[model samples]
Target: MCGIVGYVGKRDALPIVVEALRRMEYRGYDSAGVAIVDDSGHLMVDKRAGRLENLDAALAAHPAGSFAGTTGMGHTRWATHGRPTDRNAHPHVSADGKAAVVHNGIIENFAPLRAEVEAAGIEFSSDTDTETAVHLLALEYDGGEHAGDFIGSAYAVLRRLEGAFTLVFTHADHPGTIVAARRSTPLVVGVGDGEMFVGSDVAAFIEHTRDAVELGQDQVVVITADDYTITDFDGVSQQGKPFHIDWDLAAAEKGGHDFFMLKEIAEQPQALADTLLGHFENGRVVLDEQRLSDGDLREIDKVFVVACGTAYHAGMLAKYAIEHWTRVPVEVELASEFRYRDPVLDRSTLVVAISQSGETADTLEAVRHAKEQKALVLAICNTNGAQIPREADAVLYTHAGPEIGVASTKCFLAQIAATYLVGLALAQARGTKYPDEVAREYADLERMPDAVAEVLKTGPAVRDLAQSLADVNTVLFVGRHVGYPVALEGALKLKELAYIHAEGFAAGELKHGPIALLEDDLTVIVIMPSPSGRAVLHSKMVSNIREIQARGARTIVIAESGDDAVRPLADHLIEIPQCSTLLQPLVSTVPLQIFAAALAQSRGYDVDKPRNLAKSVTVE
Candidate 1:
């Protein structure tokens, strides 16, 4: 999956598409290009092998955006089936230059399709599966069977593709419209006054209008300046679900922060508050979009939380709370590996799927697999009307609007807050907790936004510590209980942003193996338990810190305020407000994010768009 932009309107397509592609550069940064249809019926595609700026330079010498038409498509490819070279950059053009295509998602059967097309005397120019689709569309448009019907030709081309893809194309013969199709990856239509837009996400078009229609699976859309028509691959008409984006264009901007990461970090408190808003009714936790009834929740005996990457860490944190509150056996599984394991499932099983972009390929496939076995699927997502939420039995949306940073900041905390809501709702349904107890926990959760805000205020110290450790070759994170997942997430952020070798270990498992790597010059971050309560855990963690410090590892402790035991052993001590055992993750995780971002910046890396990573993993 990558960035996709298509516009058919009265505005100049070049400047509009270039600006939109810049907005979506976080989606893919390997290469950027655009294909525009000029007034003289020329299909012009100018792309380069570097960042969007490279394409900007390429367009400078030969401006395709200055063409005399307002219909075009742009793409920023994150190399899937080819290398990041000039030849492999999109928009992949047909040999005749009659058609061009920009694509997201993997075309799994492109090899066989390439073979078929080659046998028919169609030569390929680029080493991309995207090229094969463009050639196939040209053939369909020029063939004896479906000649001269761009929309029908697009429908035919889509029916032959084997894997998930969102395709938007331009035809020189039909400069007034663009044909787009989707199978699994994201594609949405932006409806405006006298024009329409298509994008991989709503952010691409939010600046123009908030009126968006989310395209469903296996649907094709034909759009012009005035109107759009949605149809199935088989030519059956369908209507897409329309929704308004709650956030304005400013949410996707950096807002004068040094980086989008920093801005998103500062937005976490408000994000947490929004996620927990209006989730209570009549002293019991309420869910607005629940299709699974209280009777269904009461009958659930097992829960499986499935996700990938940072979301997988959120799922790990959710497992602890779900099992503790509902007394149901909970299992955390990597979404990419969940379906392959042949796990048993039944009506009594509840699968909780977490994804910041609900379009994550592995998690979406996992949800489908679970539903096939008669399991109830619940989605915790940020994007409204995303496929995972629309397909699941129920959904709880984390209203963290438009996290543009490649590394998750606000969404991670919001997800944790949502998980807390999920646990409370389950407990209320199962009679696992008294109503007063549930109310108290709910109130505590509501107040966590302030605690998170307090932690955000303490970010400068972590940034300072990170600047000191910029030259450190390796780092390690250790924790107990909920902090364990927080450690893993912290380590992951370090590796993703700082490009360092980092690992997270359970603090109690030190002697087994992780401690052997504790030598001089290596930094270890220990997330300590709250000392006010859980005294036993606090004592054990303090012992773990001392052991690591004794081993010559410089230890950084994330401890609670007024906790004095860790002060003597810690090389750097960061304090957070004391909260309940499970909720410590909300505050304890903040500094790690700040530190990772600062360290990456000190190393001269782009914290907003890390190398070789996309904002959304839309391909499996």
Candidate 2:
């Protein structure tokens, strides 16, 4: 995963590109660099192997007049090919120093390309798959059928490259132009009067223009100061899909919160509302892109939910809801392991792929695998114009805007809402739920925003609880049904943000192994089922809490406001508004998010950018 920004505008490119990199730094923070064609028409690159601030300090140490250009590109790298060092930073230059390139994904054929270029007496200065691209471009431009053509040489090199990647190239001689292309990885163009922009995503140029063009797979783009052109690798012209970004720059900002994670956690109510809006129309549940007919959905005999990390936890909930509502056999698999298992799939199988950023490598591959087996794929994503949605037979957008925090918050809730919508849609299509019943379920879902908002009121109490357990070396979470996934997600958040050992178990499995970890003062977080809706689960959870408490463990139970049995059992009771069993995670998850962020703050850890993690996983 990496962030890339390329601009050819009338204004100074340095500040614009640098600010864009700052906004996209959530994508990657291993290293930072910028390539600008100075006023003298010479390529100038400055990079450092650390955070963007390290590159900022390097730039500040130099005189302001040292670098100036109207055409430039910038990169913030999450190193994959080599170690995070200066030599492995992006904006890698050619041996001839005429071409500079910055790239986002892995190059599957870089080894052979590197060997071929080396045989031609080109010694690489850095150990990066991206370095081979610049060398190949220089070689192609210096002498070939397309000699003296910048775009032609760039396309020639791109045609030979392999794997998922977004690449931007600049030549010192062509200061007014930049060449960019993408295959599998994301790339977009920003339209502005008297200017043009290209980047890995809209956030790179959102400050200047919301009119964005999303490039399709294997497409190349050439951006000049005043216009842009899109084409295939063979030089055939193509049109990009244009769309407007609804939210402004303020949405991406912290909004006075100490960290983006805290602000995102607080935005869950609105995010859930936005995701559920317009999904229920004409007394029917609708998806955003429904290329498949209702007949196709009704014919589906098996369902698979594939995802990774937080999205995978959301998939676990999807499996529970889909099977319960539609009576279809549903299986949830880790995307990385889905294809390898040779899962039995066919035209009757429905593969639901969930990803916040549609470009997640493993999920994308899983989608491809399912498609290869003739399974219809539906993507539930937060991002528009991303690869997974583009490739899916249908899509249900989460509408979570942008999640800048490396550890997801609002997006996870939005995804859960999307999954429920999918379940309802399938149930309706299969005639499992009556039309009036579907409408009633949707009306209940529409009430969840208020429930989530009510849950936010418990933040101060959750913060206090988190502080009390901040010094504890271990924390365990337990729940049944949908609450079990919330427990897993809560444990994941603590482990991600607090850097401590945590685990989540099904309430019934505590005695199997996890109960052995309990000791005096050990903290165990419990997600209580709504007693009115699932009295059996609620009673079982109470018994589980009592058992943990008897073993000298301190319990923090998230339960409904009127659940008196669990209220007395919990050492610290975090009450949430009562909701249906299927929708409880929307509220139960909020406190755990607050707890994790607050706990990490108490431990003096960065709550937004967890170490060794990127916002999007573009590399497998």
Candidate 3:
């Protein structure tokens, strides 16, 4: 899950490449590096083994003053093929220093390839599979050929290797060109005036231009100082479809916040508002696209929500609403393991695949498998025109805009909001809930942005609590029903941000195993269900809180403003705005996000760029 950014443009390549790497910091990199072609046909490489700030300090120390040829490439690496050392950092160079390559995704067959290269008398310096690619390109360039021919050779070499990858490289000999290719991973090309850019995604070049071209599977792109050409792996020329990006570069910036996570936490109001826009009118929910007819939706007898990580938590939240509103059973499955188990899905089953980026390999594969089984596939995604959305039978797009942080923030809220709308649509179509009842739910959803805003005002308290517990080694979260998923999300955020041991469990399951972990020193965050809506769940959770509190755990209760039942057991209480039980996740999740971000910041870790994590999981 590394980040790759490249440019073939007229400006000084050093600053642009470095800035792009900084923008990509949220994608989780253990090391950062850049390689720029100089005016004298030399590839200038600079890299460090720490965060991007370390690389930035190095750049400042040795100011590669206006290092000027137009072609360059950069990488922020998450160590997988090698350790997090300077020698293992990306922008791997050829032995002769003629070519420098940056890559994302794993090369599964690199061991055999490396053995063959070593047998051929090539010496390797780093342990990364990416280095093999650079060596192969060097061998290809050893032949006297044009840049395009060498790119074709490189493509052929890549074709022989197994696994997923998106690679970009530039040779010193080809001073004004950068060659790139992708397979089972994402790579986008940004077009600008008199310049060209390539990145693992659009966020890399969103600052320069909003126009981008999505590279197709097994396509190689040859970019020059003034032109770019796309071709298939076999060298036949192909046309690349270009799309316009709607988000401006400002969205990627921190906007004076301490970190991207905190900034995103504050942006939730606008994000929720944007997601809610155009979704409801006259007591009916509307989707971005209606490919599935009412007959198609009504004929569906079962539902499967497939996702991974935070998206899986969203799916869990969706399951509750879908079942409650439509009177249909819904199952949530991790996409990576969904197809392997041979689930008994059929024509009557509807597979709802959720992903922020539609490029999640396992999720996309699961969606494909479901379609093969003749299941109607629906994709809920934030990104437009991504692979899963394009391939699915129907799509519900979450208009939360760009979420850059590796650990999700606004996307979680957007996903829950989208899923709620989808549930309402299903209930409306199936005649399960009354029209006025649906309208009331819609009205509750309309108030969510403000509720989110109110929850965000708890930032100061959360920050204080985070600072107090920054040194704690472990945290436990417990919730019932919808809060259970919120607990899962809470634990995930803490693990991602704080690098601490955390676990989330259903409160009902606490006495079974997890309550034993509760001690006088341990921190327990309980999401108290809304007492106004469901008395049973609310009372059960309160009793659960008292159980843990009696066991000497320091209880931090997140309860609705008017819920006084949990107050007696709460050592610390965080109050959220009053909301419907089903919609509480949209409010409860906000405080946990703030708490995690503040804790990471207090620990001196980068809240936006946590260790060993990336914003997008492009590889399986």
Candidate 4:
């Protein structure tokens, strides 16, 4: 994954480009660089191999803002083509130094292209496939077809590259212009009165303008200080569709938190509320994916949920809710492993695919595989107009706006909310629940926002406890039912941020294998089962807590406020509001998020951008 920003504006381009890179750094942080065509016709590029701060320091050391110009491009690379080193960073230049290019996405045919270019006596300075594109662009620019036409030369180069990419190129001679091309990967263009901006997402230019255009596939855009033009790969002009970004700059900022992850965790109450809005109609829950008629729904016999990482956990939770409410057997599988297993599927089956970005490679591939089996596919995604939604039979937008943190927070909550809607819709279709019963469930969901807000009030206490537990080398979590996924997610958060050994297990399986890991002073966090409707699970979880405590382990129990039984046994008790057992995760998950961020911060690590992770996984 990588983030790109290209701008042609009257304002100071250096600061604008740098800030855009910072905003989209969640996309990639392996390395960063910027290329600007200076007023004197010198194309300059300055780069660093580490975090964006290193590049900022490098720019600050220079007096001229490290490459000031009116037209420029920027990149944050995740290191697909080469090792993340100074020489292999983005904004690579050609041998003659006339052309510079910043590229996102992998080039499948870079090997042969590199060999042919080298055979022609063109020397490459870096190991990245991106450099090969710039070299080929220089060769194409010097050709007789369009020797001095920057956009034409760029279009010619795009015609040859055979992979997903969003490329930004600039020639020294074209000091007042920049050319950008989009293929399979996303590229957004922002429109201003006397300026233009192009980026991988709207966050790149949200600080300057909210009006933007979503560039189509296989299109080329040429931008100048006062105008912009668009064309197809074969040179036919096309109209670019524009839309306004609903969220403003405040949504993207940290709002005084040390990391964006912390602020996003605190914003979950509102995010889930937004996703829950406008779903009630005719005294029942409704969804945007109304393509399925009730007759079609009754014809369905099974359900399959496919996802990856955190989305996979959400899918697991969905399986429990869907089966209990719709009386249909549901199975959840990892998207990466779904198609490989040759799962039994048919038109009678419904496949629910969940993703925040809607561009996850494995999920998208899984959708195609489901269609190959003629199964009805439904997508639960946050992004509008993403590839997955367009390919699916129907779509349910999560409406979680923009989540800038590398680790998912608000999107996960919104996804679970969307899954609840899907469950209610199916229940209504199958006559499993009466309309009034569905309305009551919808009312319970309507109350979840306030529940999440009440949980947020415990952030300071959870954070301090997590900071105290930072010295522990390993953390373990256990749960009985829906709490099991919350346990797994809690462990995942600790492992992701604290970089420590962590694991989650079903409370019943403690004696099977995982219980052997418990020892003196080892921390075991328990997501206590709610005592409302599941008294058996509550009693069983209390027994599990006693067993772990007997092993000389420190127990941190996240229990409901009135659970006096677990309080006596819990070494450190964390109270969450009482809610339906199935929906307790929406609140139990908040403490885990805050604890992970605090523990990682106490260890002096960057909680927002973890090592070897990107916000979106564009490649399989």
Give each model a TM-score.
Answer: 0.98, 0.99, 0.93, 0.95
Error of 1 at 206 (Å): 1.8
lDDT of 4 by residue, 585-611 (tens): 899998988888899999999898888
Lowest lDDT 10-residue stretch of candidate 1: 61-70
lDDT of each: 0.90, 0.92, 0.87, 0.88
- lDDT per residue as tens, model 3, 23-115: 777667789999989767888888899878888887778754645667788998888888999999988998888889999888999999898
Model 1 regions more than 4 Å off: 63-66
Q: Quick one: best lDDT, which candidate? A: 2
Clashing pairs in 4: none
Task: Give me the displacement of residue 614 in model 2, in angstroms.
Answer: 0.6
Residue-level lDDT tens digits of model 2 in 166-250: 9999999889899999999999999988899998888899889989899999999999988899999899999999899887899
Q: What is the TM-score of candidate 3?
A: 0.93
Ranking by TM-score: 2, 1, 4, 3
Worst 10 residues of 4 by lDDT: 59-68
Model 4, clash count? 0
Model 3 steric clash pairs: none
Regions of candidate 4 where Cα sits further than 4 Å from its true position: 61-66, 144-146
Provide the lDDT at 371 for model 1: 95
Quick one: RMSD of model 2? 1.1
- Off-target runs (Cα >4 Å) in candidate 2 are none
Could you tell which candidate, 3 or 4, scores higher by TM-score?
A: 4
